[model samples]
Target: MTDGQLQQLVSQISLHDFKRPFRHRAYFNARLRTTGGRYQLESHNIDINPKMLTDFDEKTLVGVIKHELCHYHLHLTQRGYQHRDADFKRLLAQVGGSRYAPTPKKQTRLAYRYTYQCQRCGLVYHRKRRLDTQRYTCGRCRGPIKPV
Candidate 1:
């Protein structure tokens, strides 16, 4: 969804669930790597990770919005806005906000393309890239190696 739609959703969720009108801005933040959303205490704005919608479903997006709204509303009203506080926990539970967002899957690959054996000690090494035999040697016997 776009930033405009996100703003509308956040406002609607705040009003419908918390009985409070959210007056601040809400927008997608691409720089958010690990967090689903962040609430700015100074500006009262919400920064939502775009991955919440792209990686998950609409339900997950709503839950994250609710989670950020909990912080927004509680902080504005001068209550305990921290995660460990009783008020924050109660409000979070009442609104059914997600306690934690699921981490996105990583795309790193383990591809061992080259194998080398030590001449003297017979030590084996698996690597993704080719190593210069004349420059590198085995750790155990300090012997030269050749690719297998």
Candidate 2:
């Protein structure tokens, strides 16, 4: 969704769930890596990871928004806003917000192109490129190795 849509959603969620208005900005932040959303204490703005919408469902997106809203409301009211605080925990549970943000899945790539086995020790090694078996020996027992 666009930044304007995100702002509207956050505002709606805040009022509907928290019984308070979210007066600050809420926008997609591509730089957000690990966390699904962040509530800035200084600016009172909410930064949401755009990948959450692209990779997850609307339910997941709403959960993350609720989680950030918990922080926003609590902080604005001078209540416990940090995750470890009892007040934060209680309000988050009451609002049915997600306790933990979902981590993004990483793309996997094959790193090894070849495998070798030591003739004597049977130790195996994986390499991205071919190795000169004649010059190199097994690291464990100094035994000869052959490509497998």
Candidate 3:
């Protein structure tokens, strides 16, 4: 959805659920990596991860919006807005908002630290950390281990 649509949706959700008007901006933020949405304390603006809509459906989008709205309304009313606060928890539950934001898919690839091969069996293994090739042997054939 567009920024204008996001703003409208936030306003609608705020009025419908909180019985309060949302006067701040709501826009898609591509740089948001793990979080589904963020409510800025300084600007009172809400930044939603664009992938939330692209990767998920309307229901998920609504839930994320509700979650961010919880932070927005709570902060604006001078109540507990942080995730750990009771006010935030209670209001979030009352509004049926998502408890945690959905994590975005990681784009970067992982690095492999170690590679091992079985001398007799010719089996290979990839590991993040180095293992002692002298002590460890192949499980299938009891073969000697060597670095690949």
Candidate 4:
């Protein structure tokens, strides 16, 4: 969704869930990596991770929005808004907001390319680079290692 849709949704969720209107901007921020959304205390604005929608689904998006709204509403009312605050916890649970954002799915990249096995012990080791079989020996049986 565009920034306009996000803003409208945030406002709607804020009013519907918290009974308060969100008067701040809510938009997707591509730079947000580790978080689904962030509520800036300074700007009172919300920055949502675009991946929340693209990589996941609208359900995940709504959950994140509710979570951030918890922060936004609590902070504005001068109540306990921090994660450790009881008010935050109570409001979040009351609204059924997600406690934590879902982890984004990442592309799997195999880092190890080469595999070495100890013939005697049947132990295996994976290495990103080729191993020097002539110099390395199996730790388990002190046997010669071979490329597998």
lDDT by candidate, in order shown: 0.93, 0.92, 0.91, 0.92
Candidate 4 error regions (>4 Å): 107-148
List the candidates' TM-scores in order. Answer: 0.73, 0.72, 0.71, 0.71
Q: Residue by residue across 16-80, what tens digits does model 2's lDDT show?
A: 99999999999999898888999999999999998899888999899999999999999999999
Error of 4 at 71 (Å): 0.6
Clashing pairs in 1: none
Residue 1, candidate 4: alpha-carbon lDDT: 81
Clashing pairs for predicted structure model 2, backbone only: none
Model 1 is weakest, by summed lDDT over 10 consecutive residues, at 102-111
Give the TM-score comparing model 4 with the true structure, all chains together: 0.71
What's model 2's lDDT at 82? 98
Question: What does candidate 4's lDDT look like per residue over 64-95, in tens digits?
Answer: 99999999988888999999999999998999
Candidate 2 residue runs with Cα over 4 Å from true position: 107-148
Worst 10 residues of 4 by lDDT: 102-111
Global local distance difference test of model 1: 0.93
Error of 2 at 141 (Å): 30
Clashes of each: 0, 0, 0, 0
Selected candidate, larger TM-score, 2 vs 3 = 2
* Candidate 3 wrong stretches, greater than 4 Å: 108-148
- Clashing residue pairs found in predicted model 4: none
